[model samples]
Target: YAMTAAHKTLPLGTYVRVHNLENNRSLVVRINDRGPFVRGRIIDLSYTGAKDIGIVGPGTARVEVVALGRRDTSAAGSATTYIQDDYYSGNFTFQVGAFLDRENAERQKRELAKKYKNAHITVYDRGDKIFYRVRVGRFTTLEEAVQQEEILIQDGFPDAILVAE
Candidate 1:
């Protein structure tokens, strides 16, 4: 699937939400190319796209995709202009763990905080399920986030992945 964005460039694996008209179901798909370009279409789905909307045999279906904004990649050290009321919010920060057990997550957060001063945990509730996330650092660029992920992996958190804010 492809996502429509104001900017011409889009990175691969960019997630887009696709909604099926028939079933009112939605699925997230990755964008890898230019676009659908049809008159009124928002996204172009592949032959296996039917499976996403829960109809494998049907060739085509009306669908809508809400394109989540792309990642900001402005270079570091660029002059940033802030309005009077605007504070420097800094960059995006995320943790490594999103566990179901809060105690386990807290334990991990404490252990990580000893090494990484910025380490913290957040709890999320989705339906009846609970999730605990452990994250560190406010990174201004994706490169910094990736570097931190590498350091975390080398420190034994091999399963760590970079997430956007």
Candidate 2:
């Protein structure tokens, strides 16, 4: 219920300042979930967040977003702490697709595996439903995954994107 938002590309847990260009109101929000997948949208704010910035009634507003580093999720309750975004070394992968059906995900994985090493599926349980995410290759750095993303795109997986696994 704290101010939180969703972004397609920002790393989860990153804090960002959302500035409403229409009303000149701004607020800080944490990136937690994964979308606003519409063609031209950027961020999806919580209901309270939208109301605070005076955009709830019209349902959409032009806003500028500024990343303000990442939140330290490890720390105890309510004591917010932020860490620099520069230092992160973790498992990264290239996600080719996500499917609601397990069989569809498996089919995609099999096809990917024929030409790519480490093609697999990871299940994301979203409480009421599930998603099987098809992914290929695993790397310890973002650069490695990004390089592979381009290859995957060229090879016909146009929606391939780098994801922190």
Candidate 3:
């Protein structure tokens, strides 16, 4: 219920100003999660935030989002300027495969868990269909995840790809 939002490219914890062009309404929101995975949508505002910006009734609206930087709690809650490089530093994992059948995904996860830590299945629902994605490992740094991606690819899962969790 907090005034948080989801954005595909913004770094988590970054603050942004969402301006609804239709109503000329605006609100400040924190990027606390990643999503709006639906194609063509750039941001996903929380219920309270969308209501504040007059976007709840219509569901979606043309909006302009401006990054307002991340809050620096150590410096008296001041905000630090946004940096492009900050996006790469976060939770990451390698997706070994995706399956339409949950059992298939589970089987892959079980096999991966034998040789890897954090092997699990993440479900993605796209309205018409659901996909079970098997992923392995958890790394805070992209470099570390990429290193494992190579190993996973070489081990057998050639299609394994690094994904930010």
Top candidate by TM-score: 2
Candidates 2 and 3 compared by lDDT, better number: 2
Per-residue lDDT for 1-165 in model 3, tens only? 899999755678889989999989898899998677565688999999999999889999999998877865556445454443455678888777889999999998898899999999999997999999898999988778778877886898766656665
Best of the two (1, 2) by lDDT: 2
User: Candidate 2's residue-wise lDDT over 103-143, tens digit each?
Assistant: 99999999989999899998999899999999899888777
Superposed on all Cα atoms, the candidates' RMSDs to the truth, in angstroms, are: 13.2, 3.7, 7.5
Expressed as tens digits, the lDDT of each residue in 73-140 for candidate 1 is 56356643221211123355655677998899989888878888588887777789989988877776
TM-score of 3: 0.53
Model 2 error, position 50 (Å): 2.3
Query: Stretches of candidate 2 above 4 Å error?
Result: 9-11, 21-23, 57-62, 70-81, 87-89
Task: Write down the lDDT that model 3 would get.
Answer: 0.83
Candidate 1 clashes between residue pairs 3 or more apart in a chain or in different chains: 94-135, 95-134, 95-135, 96-134
| Greater-TM-score candidate between 1 and 3 | 3
Per-residue error (Å), model 2, residue 76: 14
* Top-lDDT structure, candidate number: 2
User: Against the correct fold, how does model 1 do in TM-score?
Assistant: 0.48
| Residue 56, candidate 1: alpha-carbon lDDT | 59
